[model samples]
Target: METLVKLFKNNIRQYGMIIALVVIMILFEMITGGLLLKPINITNLILQNSYILVLAIGMVLVIITGHIDLSVGSIAAFVGAVAAIMMVDLHWHPVVAVIASLVVGALIGAWQGFWVAYVKIPAFIVTLAGMLLFRGLTMIVLKGQSIAPFPNGFQKISSGFIPDFGSAGTNIVAVLAGILFTVIYIVNELRDRRAQKKYNFEVVSGGLFILKLVVIAAIINAFTFMLAIYAGLPNILILLLVLIIIYSFVMNKTVMGRHIYALGGNEKAADLSGVKTKKVTFWVFVNMGVLAAISGLIFAARLNAATPRAGTNFELDAIAASFIGGASATGGIGTVFGAIIGGLVMGVLNNGMSLIGLGVDWQQGIKGLVLLAAVAFDIYNKKKVTFLK
Candidate 1:
């Protein structure tokens, strides 16, 4: 039936990334002799990718505002160095060092934000200069040395997991969290359907909606199960989940989120409609900077050290993730979930290749090819959709 064909076509756009994730996971499992999805490896995959996923949240917002931030990696490294200097050299408490690092990162964002917003400079140039400056700062702060032996609590920032507080045979926290996720998914989808009906718009059919609920429930519970096997889910993983939920809510439910899309969709017109273009631009960069800093802390905590070279090339991974997740290079099109998934794709490829004992050269070559192909696919998909419309 024509209705079935049309439904399938529409659903494809919304579900393509999920489909791709499933397909790639299966293919990689086969390639790795079924090791890719092993419970331990799956848990590790999320842990290792958590930092980039955090950065991608900010990067997607930056890309949405029609700009780029090449300084995130450098900023991350610089922040880590700052924290290390505070904790190691100054003998400051680890908690104080963490807070100071985040504050420093926020101020760094404010600095770049000022240049891009008030000074009317293109983001590319400002962030590029920032990239060099921050990297140099990191080197100077670290004195070209790696610093380690952070306090146990500091290491726990990334390495620790929520302690189980339930029955001996059952992990209560994971079970409760899984239940919450299922409830939230169902409520959110129902709300979306109601809103669409109220607005006289076409909504996805009930069958498809139920299918989505089932798929989401399965994935969330499955992830929770894996975490229970590991150290019961990392603190960093919990942070990532909180961010994903909060930002996903912002992007979907808030007026500010709509403003971002509007500005991206058409900057000139949005300005004409009274959107404070400069404020939005400044805030986006500031937020990006703050996130870069947090990501830096996570990266440092994971390694339990700080180095001038930490987070090198991380900006590349974040950008590639955004592009692959369906963000147009020119801006005005992207999603938070899309960017996260994009990061995972890159993370998985890197992790899986390393597991299989692939050399760095081959990893770089293949990843570069994957990035190129992903960008090309984004372009092709847009063109196809436009033609269909």
Candidate 2:
């Protein structure tokens, strides 16, 4: 019992956010007359937030390195505009346009990264400049016009659903996928426990571990079931899942990932320990740029148009998701899963508020308050831990 209590206390930041998400979801479901999680609405929820979630994944890495990217929104807009020009005006194939856009994003990242990593400029100043520069470029590319009606192939990237193989309106694939995910999760947890025991590291109590597994399994199955009932699965959701798995593996199991954390934790010490801080910083921004480009493409595909104001305020949303997901302001903390939860929290809020007929003005204010509260809670928790120590 004491061990369980200690575990809960230690992980309050992680677990609290999840509990808050569930409570908020339930509250919204009730208030919205059961519209919040309806099949179609659930599908829309994933589609609407997919881009922000992509941004959140990249943003978490940036914040983990004790830096920020104020330019992702602009970069995404710029890339989307470039893609529009290539695909629509130039008549380039969708695949070629996508490749070109991602390349452009990388070059842009390299440009800003050179300043931040090698020139020793503050990331804040560099990214802020990038934000303005890219937004201006987006305007120039679009020439104050919206580019629309993308090729059918491109639209499918964001709007298409997985084909169902089962008859009678049943989505067997989604159900199987959910079961597979749960089994894999349980296996991983047990394996991790064994490894920890082998290395003489502390492990969670068996009962607590089992309870955790059950809760997570239930959530996963429930989510998949909802999607199965609606449209099986979305293509964008599949992309998001793949990215999450890859990034979670990178952060947890790779040497570079450890270096990043160390660099954020103590740059000078990490450098002294032979970590390539400059290279790490450079690559992180480069990676962020690539992700932003992908996000831009996804957003563009969803709308089937590229507009001048496509990514307005996107930076704020991504940043809020990262911080609200339990990322420390000082860096060297946070998880990919946490970032997803944070993005979902914001997504649900936006969706629920819209259903309740809240105006954009009220929505913005409420979101601002939520972001502020999340950061305040993080600060308070950090201080409390320091005091206890």
Best by TM-score: 2
Give candidate 1 misplaced runs (Cα > 4 Å). Answer: 1-14, 166-170, 385-389
Give per-model TM-scores: 0.94, 0.98
CA lDDT scores, all candidates in order: 0.85, 0.93
Per-residue lDDT of 87-160 in model 1, one digit per residue for the tens? 87888998788888888988999999999988989999999999999999999988899998687888888888
Candidate 2 stretches greater than 4 Å from native: none
TM-score of 2: 0.98
lDDT tens digits by residue: candidate 2, 1-389: 88778877888878888988999999999999999989889999999999999999999999999999999999999999999999999999999999999999999889988899999999999999999999999999899999988999999889998888899575888888899999999999899999999999877788889999999999899989999988888999999999999999999899988988998899999999999999999999999999999999999999999999999988999999998898888999888888998999999999999999999999999999999999999999999999999
Worst 10 residues of 2 by lDDT: 162-171
**Cand. 1 Cα-lDDT:** 0.85
